[model samples]
Target: MVIGDGILTPCISDSIVWISAAILVGLFMVQRFGAGKVGYTFAPILCIWFLFISGIGVYNFIKYDPTVLKALNPKYIIDYFKRNSLDAWISLGGVILATTGAEALFADLGHFSVWSIQISMCCVVYPSITIAYIGQASFLRKNNDLVGDTFYKSIPGPVYWPMFVVSVLAAIIASQSLISDFLHNPTIPLSRVLPLCEIVHTSPKYAGQVYVPEVNYILMLACLGVTLGFRTTAKIGNAFGIAVVFVMSITSCLLVLIMIMVWKSSLLYIIGYVVVIGFVELIYLSSVLYKFKEGGYLPLAFATILMAIMLLWNYVYKRKYYYELNNKISPERLKEIATNEKICRIPGLAMFYSELVQGIPPIFEHYVKNVPAMHSVLIFVSKKSLPISSIPVEERFLFRRIDTDGVNVYRCVARYGYRDARSEEEPFEKILIERLKDFIREDLAVNEGERLEAVAREIEVLDQACFSGVVYLIGESEVVAKQGSNLVKKIVIDQAYNFMKKNLRQSNMMLDIPHARMLKVGMIYEL
Candidate 1:
């Protein structure tokens, strides 16, 4: 209804849907190149866009009716509400569309400073948008018949083509901003072998730059479906309006809590903010929801499905964590492994991956019970993310040696910051081995003759094992709900969660974890 149709381009016929679908596919295809590069390319075009809109706005305002500025007073708001009553309230559904991408400006703040966004919003965005709308209203007064194409139709013919090109770019950028934030919620489960940090990390220079292929393609499909389904900007705008006001409403509530708990602001100030901003957003939300059947339900439906999955996953995640913690191998089990006559010691190094931070995971017990063999040089690797931005290189690996009667068993806890970018398997393995050697050099280089001899022997064994090659034993856990569990628990764990696990089998190739060199130890946990 906008670009390929007469609203923006008159000659393109009814192919706006396909044109939109093409642009959307292109956007998703390029996301893997990282947002930093994409934004850098788009930034200058955006600058040109604001200038174009502002210039056109001023031109129309002056030529058509400069006197329309008189309607800017607050009294008109009161007068209009009084004259139209409920009709005026219903108009908010359309009016809210003006503020559609406002929240995305806040979401992308991590990529830019507060001052830059503030200056841009205040100096450029605010004034340009105000003037453009006013100019559009002025143009409407003179050319009322062209209300639908008021934006494109009002442009002076000489610059109309350039403005059309700018408008298309602007539209995509607007959607891209919101889609960046949309990719985070209810993220699909990733493979145990694939680190969380690698899923979206795309840029080498910027820690925040991310492009999750799973989420990006899913969003692209959704956008294309909406384009084909809605087939018109009017219906799509209805959905857009609801999403904007709904986010604003939620932001308002979150602000109050943040003010009270985080900021420790005054109650009076909170009340004032709520009364002013909260009441207005509430009105917009109520009015927009009236169009629920007319495409307003898209956001609601999307949100509902995501929320359901998140809830189910959260329940199952907690259950699985407790099960692991409760059934972890005891310290005595480590000593028994070395003493047992039937337990065979293998040649190469074995790296067992688990969720446990301290104790050995039960998967080892399950493995040993079945095979009756263990590796000569054992290293338990637990890679987990901590609640921070980035961890120092020196502090990343926490090493602890287990005194298990010459079993040469050690525990390595690899800590990562939530925002840290974990690269390929080779780098990860290289770093861990270096850090392990460093640990031995620092802790085991004692003055005792026996201790020194033991340290030398241990290093020799490690070298021999590494030369023989290494195997990664990652646990493939299956969580089944206990018979005594409730209906929801059973449904969530055995049905919804299990189904997601099965289908969410991402290729370990992305992480460079060679499937041939890795062995998955299967374990069933009834939680």
Candidate 2:
């Protein structure tokens, strides 16, 4: 709107809305290609933007009242606060916009080195922003009538068109950065927070650079809605101010917790941190909350709805996990079932995927009780994610032989880190087979005398049998409301959890197992 109004007449400014919408849609559509391809293109443009703003700021500051620099003095801030009090505090909400993108520094830490980001900010961004704001203030002091369009009006006549172009480009780039952060960061797994969608990782070098088509379109549609509904920058800025202050307050609170728990800081340090950061953020948060009736309510409304969904998901998941832990069969029970001659044995290898590491899942027992048959080679597989970024390939899988019967029963645990890519390029069956082969070779090398011979013989038979085929088994379990449960539990488990389970990506698809060889055993839990 500023760019269109600045360069063109009022007639052309109306068309700028549709133009902005089209550009936003185009930016989101190109996200599937990944950030690595597009991130570099923005760097030079951003540099130019900073330099231009700083240069204009310096020029304007020198031409107008150089005395305006006196506003930087601490006494002026103190005097203004003392004089206006509540009004001054309320205006601080507008002041937060000056530091809008500062949070991105911490967010982009995953993409760039700390030292590099610090150097860039210290040398270019901070100085540029400081001078640019001072220059805007100086320009406004002289030309009070042009306060609404100060940025465009301050530009020199000769370079107006070029400056307008740069402003529009910079605005689009800024919007793109925020949209990408919303889609990728907060570290929430798409399967848990959203419905099933293909999440494409664009950069192999940076696991954080992901593109979700569903999220991208959703964001685009939302941007269009806000743009059309508000039809003015002032209303949008009001909502934007609420969102910025809310995020800042939340970030400060999280940092305080991290300092106490992760850094193990002293009480003195905690008090100082809270007094410095918390005081400022709380003031801003309170100011924004006061404006809740005037467009500020939009962000709080959205956040409340989202928080309810996440809380319900957490509750249901915990209940289901507790139920599974209590119902899991003991290892002795599994051995007894394995040794039973009454159970007919089938010919192929069967891998049952379950959540428990130490015991047999109820789903497996249910499958066997109904069919009255077990596979020649039984393997229970569990894939667990650790808190770290990536696990070493050598330490990825752990295998242990369970029962000594002619039909071999084994347990395999595959460990992965949170950021580790579970590439679908290699099938799960193939990886498991290779890991098992490695385990056999290692066991043969380590064991002495009679044990070595036994291991070799077992490996030979296992190799031949595995060559036949493999079957992947997983449970399709659902949680139902148990008798005497409260209303909240019933609503959370029977309704919310069931709805999410039905909509989310299935377990077999997530594991990348082939549909033809996969068996999904349906089961119900009265929890």
Candidate 3:
């Protein structure tokens, strides 16, 4: 099924092929090692590529012959349009090629500051491109030939080869970057998460920068198909341009909604962003729509498929995540875990294990039945995956510890990402403790063969300040009873039997009704 170059006649130029190869190789290296540095290197190189093309475009424009110009006037553009309006619509299939690269811009926001991207666009990309496009216009008028081929021939010596190489590679890199943006930012912040609030919240890790493998692969295939199938830049750009404009148009609409109702700010902000996006989209749309007869439908068809996939994937992933979380809460087990605690002789200390931190749990009512006098200090324990490799101080601040009426409640919550949690064999608590020790000892420096007694001694001091007199583990009922405890031990165990019955295992509520003895209610809070 090898189609000869006959179908792709215009790509016979060795120079163009060589340039494209260089651009591809350069980007691959950049993607691997240039995460934070891409903007500095990439933006400048791209700007140069744009300027070089624009310069050729401008030169071609100024030197257009008068006779040739007469035939290529607006009439030719209109006639070509009118004669094949339907065909032009079909050609829109190719428009997908242009916007395929736009996702990369969003993905790279973290790598480069927003201001840096803007600066590169203004200083290098825009002006150079303006000149080249003008040259393209002029060249078209004089030669009555395919504009891409004309521009290629006009380049002096080997310069054409390098320019071609740069242009194609830059285009592909740009495409890959856009795909990355979508994977990292899944939520519709203003509309879904924070509709009433003006400011949107995001963790530093979930910032606008992201990479999407699916989108990248799809784009690669689409771009390769267009390149090998058509061989002429003009034919590809026509279709690519339309798809780019369509995506831009949708993005503009979303941005406007965010600016108006979501942000609900002033008119100046709205108009400025809208106008810029509008102008760019309009230009591309005009190009693709006008060239419908040549080739455009190819991109439009591909873009429609891509957008549908994006919408569906987000919906399913979020739903499954929440479902598993709610299923883990247990009432009966939480009660058994909370009740078996040892009341310390130390006056202010209180230690008990219960899965209930938030909402109604059996442990809260149990405190009312057993001990009328609540202990002054409370320690709540939870089992989760290991601590983060490096816990940023900001992440540590997420927990709130407070003292009320000589009683201290320490509520500990643990977290684990999907990769580590999916392993079936290992117990979570052991992994969690190891992680905590690693985090606490992260900065300690000692020879590998040397004992960690000195570091351990220092860490114990810090731990005493944090862990001190009473420590409780909220775990299973069987584990709590079998562990064996008396008043002497500072540690308290909570099997969380009630919590397991209520939340996780879902037991009958009537069992605790008749003999229901409620204890002095401790702090009532929900997770």
Q: What is each predicted model's overall lDDT from 0 to 1?
A: 0.75, 0.74, 0.44
Native-referenced Cα lDDT, model 1? 0.75
Best by TM-score: 1
Clashing pairs in model 1? Answer: none
Model 3 regions more than 4 Å off:
1-30, 61-111, 146-148, 161-165, 172-239, 262-333, 340-410, 414-527
lDDT per residue, candidate 1, 309-388, as tens digits?
76777777777778888888877987897669999988989998877887988889999999999888999988766545
lDDT string, candidate 3, 1-527, tens digits: 00111112112222354454344334433343323344445656666677678766655666764244454467875786598986755444453342343433443464457897788667766666556655665666656667446657666565778877786656554543442342233435321221111111122332443333333233444444555666666665565455456655666787799889988969998788778878756655665677666765665555455444344333322332233245333444433333434432233334344434442334434453554443444445432322222233223212223323223344545444212331336543334344445543553467754437655864454355335433332222221222344532212113222232234211112111111222123342121
TM-score of each: 0.90, 0.88, 0.49
Question: What lDDT is reached at residue 30 by model 2?
Answer: 77
CA error at residue 346 for candidate 2, angstroms: 0.6
Query: Global CA lDDT of candidate 3, please?
Result: 0.44
Model 3's TM-score against the true structure:
0.49
Pairs in steric clash, model 2:
none
Per-residue lDDT over 136-234 for candidate 2, one digit per residue giving the tens place of the 0 to 100 score = 899989999998778888887887888788877787777766655665544655445544566666665666777877666766676776666766665
Where model 1 places Cα greater than 4 Å from the true spot, the runs are: 1-15, 184-198, 385-396, 415-431, 506-511
